[model samples]
Target: MATLPYWRLSGFYLFYFALLGATAPFLALYFHHLGFSSARIGELVAIPMLMRCVAPNLWGWLADYTGQRLLIVRVGALCTLFSFALIFVSKSYAWLALVMALHAFFWHAVLPQFEVITFAHLREQPERYSQIRLWGSVGFILTVVILGRVFEGLSLDVYPVTLVVVMAAIVLCSLWVPNAQPSSGNRKVLADGFFKQLRSPGVLAFYACVALMQMSHGPYYTFLTLHLESLGYSRGMIGLLWALGVVAEVLMFMAMRRILLRFSVRRVLLFSFLTAGVRWLLLGSFAEHFWLLLLAQLMHAATFGSFHAAAMTFVQRSFGPGQQGQGQALYATLAGVGGAAGALYAGYAWNTLGPTITFSMASVAALAAAVIIATRLQEDRP
Candidate 1:
């Protein structure tokens, strides 16, 4: 039996998400510092997500064709580091947009391939994935909480420095973790072709719901910090609020084994969509109240934690061994498309319709996802 490189895998997730922790909460604020409008900020943030629509599938196919997933991850990590370094050269909107899109194209390629590698390592025990993935949440918490305080002392100008450090760490971790190919026997068990699996009603519904679920997160991902700041929340407090959500996610991941054993993936996903709708409604309606905001943040357990674990499981079970790369890639693609749409719409709506209506739109998107899951998603038997 091969030893699971638990810490290595965990370390990569830690640094990768630490990068996200630094960027997602503060990037909009950084754009605000540069005096960009909400629409432009939305476009800037949406660039990487738009890249996700195409980058993952392209890279995923190459990985599957070549069987060099880890190599792809390494090259991607390096490319992301170099591309993002260009941000320091120009602060122009066009330049920044191009850099973000370029960096994201490579950055987005890393995760889906890494996910396939991780699943390859886990082999038969897919449930243990949450255990390994929880480190990412811990990283998110640490970065958000610490950076929240750091940004309070410093300005958003320090944001790029923090991101660069985390990105470098990702490259180092990618180098440290060697690849593990699935056994030939496992690969031989490819029962369904990728396209055939994708053609299933359940598969189609699941992907649609996945897209909508992420779409619902657009405002939160793109502008939650700015929204809270407008409500008189300090940077540190906003970071804590962001950390609070991931803390809930970490706890949920810790308990995911029990959750999975008790509930069907379809059921968990349905509940996630419903909770997301409610969470968005509360966020839009009562963000000024600390308790309500905290309560809303707690919903991250359902919205992302359980939803993601369930979605991964659905993809794993739906696609055969040879198809894992494409399955994960497809998931990333739809998520990217949905996220881009969400960010674009949120950007347009934020200035004109304001935060309340913008978030209400997120709520409607979540509700729509719930309906799709409820009506069209079928439970696959173990």
Candidate 2:
């Protein structure tokens, strides 16, 4: 039996999500600082997500074929750092778009493979998955909270430097994590007919639902800070609001085992979609109310926290061991597609439809996802 390198795994997630922390709250703000229109900002931001649709699946296939996941992770992390470094050369929309495309192509490849590696280490104890994964929430909170103040004190031009530091950390952590072996003899069986399992109705519905869930997050990820700024909130407050949502996510991760024990994954997923719908509706209707906004942020416990936990477990169980990388990659792919669509629409809608209508569309997406899961997905009980 292998001892789980608890902190090693945790450290990787911490640094990895820390990069997200920097991007999610401030990247759009950075582009805004450059005086780009909302649509251009959306296009810039969407570059990475658009790459996610193809990058992870291609990398996952290679990892499965070669069984060298850690090697792939390290190379991907290193390339991401190099690509992102190009931002210093030029800040033009064309230049930044090129950099974002290259950076995200490599960066997005790191996570889904690492997810399989994490579960590989956990082996028979999948319940411990969230405990290990919660460090990512911790990483996000620290970055959002600190960078919030940092941006307030300094200029948004400093954002890229901060991201570079985090990217370096990711590269270092990738080097530190050891390669995990595939499950015993499961690879051969899994390799034989992986795509056959992918054709199931439940699997199809689950990916569709996953896409919608991520699509609904577009406005939040792409423009929440700007929206709050428009509503008279400080930069620090916007950061705290972002941290608050992840704090809710952290708490949910801590209690995920208990939650899973009591409810079926289908039940949990249905609840997550419904709660996400409410969250979007509240944000669209009452974003000017700080208290209401806080309440809506708390729904992150379900929107991302429970939804992600349930969805990851569902993917793990749905496929055999050899196919886990692809399972996780498929999740990333659909999420990329959804996120890209959401960000694109949110960009166009932010100026024309306004935040209320923009986010209302997100609410409708989540509700529609709920309908899909309720009708098409079955409870995965073993």
- Cα deviation in Å at residue 159, candidate 2? 1.0
Question: Which portions of model 1 show Cα errors greater than 4 Å?
Answer: 183-192
TM-scores vs. true structure, each candidate: 0.97, 0.98
lDDT (Cα, tens digit) per residue for candidate 1, span 214-238: 8999999998999999999999999
Residues 3-66, model 2: lDDT tens digits: 8999999999999999999999999999999999999999988889999899999999898878
Q: Count the backbone clashes (under 3 Å) in each candidate.
A: 0, 0
- The residue pairs that clash in candidate 2, if any, are none
- Quote the positional error of residue 363 for candidate 1 in Å: 0.6
lDDT accuracy of residue 22 in candidate 2: 92
Cα deviation at 148, candidate 2, in Å, is 0.6
Score residue 177 of candidate 1 by CA lDDT.
Answer: 91
